[model samples]
Each structure stands twice: as C-alpha cells, then as structure tokens.
Target: MEPREFFIEDRLERFRLKAFCNLGESGLGFFRLEEVLGMAGISVSDLLDLPMNDAPNQGSLELRSAIAKLYPGVSPEQVLVTTGTGEALYLAFHMMVKPKTKVALIWPAFQALYEIPKMLGAEIIPVPQEKAFLASTWKEIDANLYILNHPHNPTGKTFPDAEWENLLSWFREKKKLVLFDEHYRFLPGEGSLGKTGVDPNHSFFGTGSFTKCFGVTGLRVGWLVAEESFVQRARSFKDYLTHTVSPISEKIALGLLENKESFLPGIQTRVRNNIAKFTSLWRKLPHTKDFTVPQGGLVGWLMLEPGISSEAYADRLFEKTGVFVLPGSNFEEEGFLRIGFGETEERMAEGLKRWSECTDLI
Candidate 1:
C-alpha cells in the first residue's frame, strides 16, 4: 500500500541545505561529543570495552528501570525500548489500530500521530489541542483510542492540571484507551512542566525520547510505557524490525539517564532564554499577527495577516532570506507558520534577525 505524504519532512529535506538560518528544526542545538560524554560522566574508553552484541529486546534492566523513574508506579517490565519515539509510536499504533478503528487525535501535531493510524486503516478524528481536554468536546466525539501530545507539537500548548485530571477520569469511566506522546515533557514552559501522574500499567500508553528535551538526537533512543501485556506484544513486534537496540547506544543511554540531574536543568534554562529571544524578535516583525505563546515544546506558531497563505509566505521568506520556517499548512493549519526556537542562542538570534530584515519581501 502507498504511504501518506509527510509534508514537514519533505519540505525540510528539499530546503534544509539551502537555508543558512534554520527555524524549522525541532530538536535543540547539537552537543559536542566531549560535552555529552562529560555530562554522562563517561569516557571514550568506557564505551570501547562494551561488546558489540544486541542489547535485550526490552532494553537493559538498568535503562528500563531508569526510564520507569519518570512515571509514578511504572515498572521496568512495562517499558519497551525502541529506535526512537517514532518507532515506539509506530509499534503502539500497529498493535492497537486496525480496520475502521476510531481514533481521536489532537490536530496540528507531529504528522506521524495521524499518518500511521491512517496507514493502519484507522478512522482519524481530529481534535483541536485547545479543546482536547474539554468535557464538551469529548461528548460529541466517541472514539476507541485517544492520542494526546502534551506540550503539543507545533503549538506547544499544554493541558491544565484540572483538565488533565478530568480527562483521565473520563477515560477511566468510559474505558477508553489513551496514548500520550510526551516528547517535550521534560522541557519546562511558563507554568507547566508537562509531567503527568498517570499509571501506564492500565489503559494508557506513553512514549518519549531523549532527542528533543535532552539534545540526545544522535542516539536515536526512545521508549514505550504501557501494561506488561502490551509491552510484551511490542517487544515481539520489534523483533521484525531492528529487533534490539545496539549494545553501545543502550550503554550510553544508561549513562545519560544516570547523570541527567546534572545536565537537564541547564538545557531547560537555555531553551527558556532562546524562547525569549524568539518572542522579542517576533513582536517587532511587521505584517505578523499575534500568535500562541509556546507553553513547552521547541516550536511555536506564528500567524501572518489574514488571507495570506502560510505555505506561499514561507516559500517567499526562504527564497529571500535563506531562513527556513515551516508553514502551518504542513500540519493542516493553513494560516500560520511554525518556528522553532531550539537552536543555540547565536543561531537563533541570527535566524530571527534574518527573518526581521526580510519582512518586506515575505
């Protein structure tokens, strides 16, 4: 069967190298090998002695145990390590979604949330992130599975605490399944940290990676948390894919988790500062309309004048300024653009400045 077109990835692939200032990338700036190793307290020699064999399919005991610490009442057996959050999500959707399966998915999210289920023949019902946690919205739409991207992608809006609790209560009462994509969960926003107290051992599934929040993109390590039965099935399904993570990556991931306390706070601080720089510039740009302030993720939406086409505007901006920002049309929201602030302070400033200078052309 043919796959759905992934607009965001396709656009980036075509224009990434042409742009000198990138405001489209979602992950944080790169970390040097030495800096990363130092943060993990691991030396090059430490990794050399590791055997080049496959790690346990379910992930190493130490790594799984460390991941479990993030969620209250979760056990190592409930976690299945995968290639990345994408793969974890794929496995979850593959197992749970089938022909005509009704899924309530938050809109303008990472495309995989919608595409993968559609590929599996699931009927997707788009729910706006703002209304996702509201009781009124849920009343009109009844679906077997609900997908929520907390500190949501593209927009970064988060569910308020009471609303999250109410939604969880509703899920429990209705016996519905919910899957949370928490890729940005570790990043702190104005008033939210995106942490949830849900127990994944029940009817919930959660997935995340070190890629976004921790700047561990190269490692490609992520995980799925669910009931033990689901974990077992995922692990079995994984055997058809990469089967097991590389011995080296798993060991390094273990090191990062062990020393996260020493580095994560600093990353959070840097991102907040970057966000400030982005907003400061955004406010001064002409022809732009007020947009949503990101509550947590690396990206935020920027609206342009009404009747303007976001994709056309983004194209002109990129051609004139060599600065690339994703159009909201990529996420099925046509009137806005998604700009990422996860670059280093220097790069972010330069990119924003470029956009500011080219306002007349765009």
Candidate 2:
C-alpha cells in the first residue's frame, strides 16, 4: 500500500541532526533518569531489583491500577498499556478502521490520528477546529469513528463545556465510536483535569502517554482505555508489534503515575510561564498574524504573513538561526507555524531570541 507521508515525524527526524535551538517539539521537556527517579522517590535499589524482562502484554496490574486512578470509574482491566500513546492509537485504528469506514477527524491534528486509519483504507472527514464541536458537524457526518484531540495539538484550542455535553449526547444517540486523544488533557487550564469521570460506555476509546504530562518520553510508556473486551483485543494485536514494554520502563511509569501529584503542578506552571515567554517574543515578529492563544498543551499556532510559504520560512529560519519550528503544512494547514515552548526557560529564551533574530534577517 502506498501510504501518505507522515510530514511531522519526517521533518522531526531530519531536525534531530542539525537543530541548535529546537522549537518544534510538542511535548514537555525530556527528563533524565536521575531526575525522574528523584521526583518519584524511587531509589537505585528499587530499579536494581527489577528483572530485565518483558512486562505483561497488557501491562502490569500495578501500573494499570495507577493509570486507572487518573480516570474515575476506570479499572485496571480497562487499560491496555503500550509502548506509548502512538502505539495505542495504532492498535485502536487497526482494530476498528477498515476499507470504506468513515472517520470524522479533527483537523490540524497529530498526523497519526488520521493517517493510521487512512492507511487502513478508511475514508476521512475532517472537522475544522473552528466548528469541531458544532452540533452540525456531529449530526451531519455519518462516520464510523470520531477522533478528538482534547486541547488539540498545534493550536491547543479546546471546545466549550456545552459543546462537549452536546457531543456526548450525540454519541449516546448515535452510538458511534469516539476516540479521545487526551495526551494534553492534564494540562492546566480552567477545565483541565475536569474530565475525571469519563463516559461510562463502550463508545469511548482513550489514548495517552507519560511523555507530555510526566515528561518521561524515554520510557515510551502509554496506555489505551476502553471496554475490557476491546482492551484484550488490543493486547493480542500488540503481540505483532513490540509485544510489551520492558519491565524497567513499566516500573518507572508506575512510579511516575503514583507520584504525579508531586510533579504535575510544576509542569503546569512551567508550561504557562514558557507560553508567556514565547508569546512576548513571537508577537514582535513582523510576519506573524492570526496568533491563537493556546489554552493548554506545549505548542501554539500563528499564521505567517500571507504570501510567504510557511515551509519556506521555516526552512530559512533553520538555515539562518539554527532554530527549528514546524511548518503548518505538516499539519495540512498552510500559512501557519507550530512553536513549542516546552523546554527549560533558559533554553526557551535562547531559542525565541534566535527565532526573532531570523525574522529580522528574513
């Protein structure tokens, strides 16, 4: 099958080699093993005692139990741990999406959300962020699965509570599957973490990872929350992939979840401060317009001055300043850019400075 190119990951892979100031990532800053263990209060002895073996295919009970605690009414059996949220998305789309199946997807999303299903020969109906939660979008589109990225990626705009209530009611009436990519749901905002009690129905399929909220990307630990039967099916499908995460990673993930209360507040504060820092600088650029204030998530969006190609400008920025940012074209929305501020304040300041310098030169 000739699949569509995954532009975001492709550009990121190339950026890894020469990026001096990275502003393209969409998650929290990476944490060192020592820092994570320190925050989680895990000791060297605790890690040493872990066996160097594969964890349970569906994840350890201890880890799943910790994850379940985040979502009220969810039990360990309803969670299927995977390498990361990326894999969890793959498992669900693979299982549910098929030829001719229509998927209603939120636009300007992480490419994988739609790309995976498209690869499975599914038909995609894009729902623009401006009207994503509109009753018309839900009622008008007869889709097999609806995908929503809470506090959506790139733009970070969230729907209103009333819209959410309306959508839930629609789901109850339609009984169609809805995939909630809540990777950034834990972000601090007026309604952040308010989704404590998920809809107790077979219609909801949720995927998230520790990378964004916990800043433990190296662990590659994430999970899928669905009905017990669907989770079991996903676990079986995982055997064809990585099968299971390493026990060491699972142990560390468990520690992170168990002690999330200690670190999450700090993460929220850092993200808010970084967004402030970034906006203060970004607004000064002559070429930026239509700037969207991010409600939550690590990244935000601003349109490039019309007539200037976002991809061309981004390439030029990297060339002139050694700073990297994602072009909006990667998200299928041109004339904009996604700037990440989820780094140390010092690094973010320097990156923004370099980015600003490039704007003047361009």
Candidate 3:
C-alpha cells in the first residue's frame, strides 16, 4: 500500500529553515536552552553530568511522573513517553486501528490525524466542526473511533467545557474510542477538549508535547496518556520503532516541567503581545474576508479574495517578500491561509507588511 505525503510538513520542510519571515509555524516561538535552564536555576554543568545513554523505553520515571501530573489522577504507569507527539499519534493509530475499522475524524485538522488511519485501512468519515457544532452531523456516521484536535490547528476554534462533556458522553454511549490531540492544551487561555484524567472505564487517549505551549521543541519530548493497559500495549509496540527517547532530551524536559511555573507566564505574555500585533496588521490588509480572531493558539486563519487560491497567494507572497505562510490547502481546504503570530513583534510586523505588499500584487 502507498502512503500519502504530509502536505503541511512537506511545505514546511522546504521553507521553514530558509524563510526570512516564517508566519506558518504552528507553535510558540522556541526557547533557547539557556533560557529554559535559567528559569529552572540549572547550570550547564548540571546538564553536562547526565549520562548519554538512551532513556528507558517507557521513559525515565521522573519524566513520566511529571507528564502524569499534567493529567489529573493519571499514574506514571499510564503514560508512555515518545520521541514527540508525532510518535505518540503513530503508536496510537497502530495500536487501536484495524483494517476497515470505521473512524470519524475532525476535518481541516493536522493531516496525520486522519491520513495515518486511512493508511491503516480504516474507513474515515469527516466530521466538520460547523456541522458537528450544530449536532446534525453525528447522526449520519456509524464510527468505531473518533479523533479530535483541541484548540484546533489552522482554525484555532475551541469548544466549551459543556460541549466537550456532551461529545464525550455521546462517544462513551456508543462505546467508541476517542483520541484527542491536546498539543495546544496549555496555550495560555485555551479551553481543553481532553479530559483531565484517564477514565478507567473509557477508551480515551490524549497526546501532547512540550514543543507547543512549553516552547521546548528541540527537546522533542511528548507523551501519550491512557489507561494503564493501553499504555502498556503502546509501549510494547514502541520497541519496534525508536525504542527510547534521548537521555539528554529527557533531562532537559524534566527541568522545564519542574520549573514550568516560572517560564510559562513569560511565554504567554510574548504570545499575547505578538497576537495583538498581528491583529493590528490584519485590519489593514485588503480583500481579505472570513477572518476570525483566533481564540487560542498561535495561528490565525484568513480567506483571500474570491478568485485567489491559498496556494497561489502563499507562493506569490513568499516569492515577492520571503515571507512564508501556510496555504489552507495544506489542511485540506483551499482559498485560505494560516498565519502564525508566535514570533517576536518586530518579525510579525515585518511579515505582515510583506503580506500586505504581496496581496496588493494579487
């Protein structure tokens, strides 16, 4: 069987490192190691002393315990630390999906959410938020599993706690498994869609990472939280993959988690400031419509003029101004672009100014 290429990631791989202004990245601006360590009151000498061996396959006990604490009532045994959320997601699909299993997936999501399951031969039914919010979409699909992303990517829409409760109740009643990609769960003021704890009787799984809200992408630390039995099964499957995380990454991640209280406030402040700057610039742009202020996360979505496709606009923008923005087609939709406001104010301003210039050419 052939696998599909990941559209957004592939485009990012081409432009991310080289772009003069990157307004397509999905996470908060990354933190330097010194900044992370400084917040934790750790010195280079402390990091230097950690052994260079591979971390335990299930992750170091301290790291797993720290991750467990993020989800209320979860035990260390219920967590499986992976290389990143990508691995956690991969493991989840591999462990739970069978050929022809019916899957319902949130639409315009991170491609891997549905693409991987589709590759596993699961029959996928798209659940668009507009229809799902209206509660009319669920009646049409008979699915065995449901996948979701919280504080969703591309659109950055979040559901209220009561809505999440009702959605989860519906899944539980149907005896369907639910997978929540909670990568942006801690994005300052975002409401979370994932449950606070592992329910002993429910087949719910949560995937998250230090890369997004924690601004520690280089550490590549992420995890899966589920029932102990499911975690154990995932861990066994992980042995066939990367086997274990890097000991160095585990050590740094532990430091960040331990000092989260000190670092998060500052990161959140920068994110909010950048967002405000982006909003100011967005108002000055021309021929843009259907734009919504992102409720949470770092990205904002906007539709361009009627005749222009997002891919064409993004290409022209990059060609003329060296500013990179993700085409909405990357998320399986067209005529829109995803603009990231996770950079410094100066960078965001320059990118937006460039974006204005490019749109003028359009």
Each model's TM-score? 0.95, 0.95, 0.93
Candidate closest to the true structure, highest lDDT: 1
| lDDT accuracy of residue 330 in candidate 3 | 91
RMSD in order of candidates: 1.8, 1.8, 2.2
State in Å the error of residue 151, model 1. Answer: 0.9
Q: If ranked by lDDT, best first, what sequence of candidates would result?
A: 1, 2, 3
The lDDT of model 2 is: 0.81
Q: Which stretches of candidate 1 lie over 4 Å from their true place?
A: 190-193
The local distance difference test score of each candidate is: 0.83, 0.81, 0.78
C-alpha lDDT of residue 106 in model 1: 76
Per-residue lDDT over 1-362 for candidate 1, one digit per residue giving the tens place of the 0 to 100 score: 64588889899898866777777878886687788889888899988888898899999999999989888899999999999998899899999999899998778778999889888898999988667657668767889888888778888787777777777777777777889888887785853345763467558889988766777788889999999999999999999998998887788888888887788888888888888887777877657887777878788888888888889888888888788889999998888888887677877787778777775654
By summed lDDT, the worst window of 10 consecutive residues in model 3 runs over 191-200
RMSD (Cα, Å) of model 2: 1.8
Q: Once superposed on the true structure, which residue ranges of model 2 sit more than 4 Å away at CA?
A: 190-200, 359-361
lDDT tens digits, residue span 1-362, model 3: 65599899899899887778888899766668787778666789987887888889999999999988887677898899998999999999988889999988777788888888889999988887566543335646788877777667877776666766776677777776788787876673533223442353577778888677766777778999888888898999999998999988888788778887776776677777877776666756666777777766777788877888888778877888888889988988887889876777677778778767664546
